[model samples]
Target: MPAIEVTSLSKTFRTKRKAAGLGASLRSLVRPEFRTIEAVRGLSFEMEPGELLGFIGPNGAGKSTTIKILTGILFPSGGEAKVLGYVPWKQRRQLAYHIGTVFGQRPQLWYHLPAIDTLTLFGKIYELDDRQTKRRIAELAEAFEIEDLLETPVRKLSLGQRMRCEVAASLLHKPKLLLLDEPSIGLDVVAKQHIRDAIRTMAAQENVGVLLTSHDAGDLEALCKRVIIINHGQIVYQDKVSALKRSFLTSKLVEVRYAQQVGADFRIAGTETLKVAKERYGVKLRFDARITPVGKVMAALSAAGTLVDITISDPPLEEVIAAIYQKAENRE
Candidate 1:
């Protein structure tokens, strides 16, 4: 059976509308208008056991709403979902033992207490034996590099440190499935890598399925095998991460540094020069690999001057996702 089975899953929220100005507000209070927001609509998907799935979108794209519904934290307006073979909203209490979650914007750690205190409390809440709980804590501390931070007060820890602790807390139960919403938010480059690596290791070791949502493209590239892109409360694209890259990650960003100064108007054929260093020794460029082979660009740069450094990368994940949204909107 699939780790997560969501069929026609949907959630709609009704918000009371208030007009501007005191008079209008007063009248609205007497007869309030409500706006119906379709946070999730007709969503259908399934995640296999031990699968790493990326569910990503822009702000207000219903990523968080879908996660919450699957976790049984909110009632969906319509449709249904089963998490680990249990109906989410109907069997939430029973299903709680099998899943872990981390919401980036919400704090699960105690503000005034050290993170260890919260972790220990979770051990009890999850019914973990004291001996096993200690062992798990030790393992997670090493994996997350939080042995030192665990003792510091959560309020005293930096956002990155606290986030490491928060994710560790979620894994205290050694859940079979993880639902992470923006797990890498507020994390720096190195910190983000640490979290991704740790999560990947833990998932592999335990055969845990992961459903992750993040704005950072690096997270998806690093952690997920498959990705589902959502927009306006619906799925716009779903495919293997490699396939998504092959289709939309066509352009490459190349930055190169030379050992000596070059002409200010330096340009390459079939490539766009995004920037040239003020020192005249370095240049930033972009090109479609399909048009100008990567080997050609490298050869041209090599022949120009003694190479000092070079960097090549794909366009941002946001750019690729935006293209998807545009294509979907045009079709609609």
Candidate 2:
């Protein structure tokens, strides 16, 4: 059976309309206008065990709503879903034992308590034995490099230090499924690498299925093989990361810095000048898949002038996503 399966799952939230003034706000207490907002509309997908999938979308795209349904924090209004052979909404109590969740915006640790105290609390809540809890704590602390932070109070630790403890706290139950929402948010380069490495190691050793949501494409590039892109509460694209890039992007961006001033004709054939500076210029050029490869980027710029330096950049994931949204808007 698939580790996670959803068929036309949907969620609609009823929002109350409140007026601006205090009189109107007080009046709302007597009677309120209700608006039904569909957060997730007819979404469906399946994932196998031990798979690492990236779920990404713009704000108001219903990414969080869908995750809430899959993790059993909220009920779907239509269709159905099965995660690990159990209906998530109906079997949340049972599912909690095997699924772990980490929310980047919220710390699971208690502020005044030491990091180890939070782990102990989680151990009791999950009903783990003393021996199992100790072993899991040791393993995760070592892997996450939070051994020093264990004795420090949660509120006193640095953001990166606290994040490490948070992740370690969530995994103390030995969950089979891990749900991470923006786990790398606000992390610096070195801290981001450490978190990504820890995630990769856990997924490999524990054989857990991970569903990660992040605004950072670098996180997806480092941890996930497959990605599901959502827009306006529906799936826009679902495919391998490599295939998504290859199929959606038709052009590459090249930035060049010249030794001296160059004429307008110095531009590449069939390329557009995105921007030009005193001694530097950026060009957008189409690549015919087989004709112009990455290796030829510097050489092509050399033909234009005495090239000082040249760099090739892939189209940003945001650009590809915007293109998809524009296509949908046009069709609509």
Candidate 3:
């Protein structure tokens, strides 16, 4: 069976409307105004065992709501859902043993206590025996490279170190499904890579399915093979990461630093000079990867001046997501 299955799942929230004026407020006291907001609309998807799926969307696009419903934190308004063969909302307690969750903004570790203490507490909560708990902790500490940070107080650890410990704690029970929301948020590049490597290793060895929600494109690119992107509470795109790039990634940005000064009039065919710092021997250029080969651009740059340093990168993921959203909006 698939690790997760959902058919037309939806959620609606009832909220009180604000009163505008004093008279309106007084009248509202007698009878309050209300509004119904649809947070998730007819969402359906499936994840297989050991699959790394990227569940992504813009702010308030129902990403968190969908995760909450799947994890049984909130009940859905409509539709059928099953995770690991259990209805999350109906069998939450039973399902808890098979799944793990980590919300980057919310720390599950006790602030004043060492992370090792929290891990022990979690082991007890999960009903692991004493020997089993110690063995699991040692394995996780090694996997996450947090062996040195285990005894450090949660408050004293750096954001990256704490995050590593948090992830390790979640895995102590050897859950079959892991839900990670912004796991790499507020982490440096090196720290992000560490989390990614650990997650990759765990998923491979444990055969644990992962549903990762992150705004960092690097995380998605490095970890997820398939992605489901939602906007306006509906899926706008779902496909392989490579396919998404091929369809939406049309341009490349190149930055170069020359060893010597270059003229302001420096130009290359099929490329646009975005910025030119003549005195500093720095230039930023952009070209359509679909039209002009990156090899040609590199050759042009090399011929222009003695190259000191060069970097090439795709456009930010936000830009790609915006383009997809705009297209979806236009179609509407």
* Model 2 spans > 4 angstroms off: 280-300
Q: How far out, in Å, is residue 1 in model 3?
A: 1.6
Compared with the true structure, what per-residue lDDT tens digits does model 3 show for residues 109-186?
999999999999998999999999999999999999999999989999999999999999999999999999889989
**Pairs of colliding residues, candidate 1:** none
- TM-score of each model, paired residue for residue: 0.90, 0.91, 0.90
Please give the RMSD to the true structure for each candidate, in Å.
2.3, 2.5, 2.3
Model 2 gets an lDDT of 0.84
Arranged by lDDT with the best first, the candidates are: 1, 3, 2
Candidates in order have lDDT scores of 0.92, 0.84, 0.91
lDDT of 2 by residue, 226-323 (tens): 99988778888899988988987767777777777766545554455666664444333444434566566556667777866776667887788778
Indicate which candidate wins on lDDT: 1
Question: Which residues of candidate 1, in runs, are more than 4 Å off?
Answer: 256-267, 276-281, 297-310
Model 3 ranges off by over 4 Å: 20-24, 257-261, 295-310
**Clashing pairs for predicted structure model 2, backbone only:** none
Q: What does candidate 1 score on TM?
A: 0.90
Question: What TM-score does structure 2 among the candidates reach?
Answer: 0.91
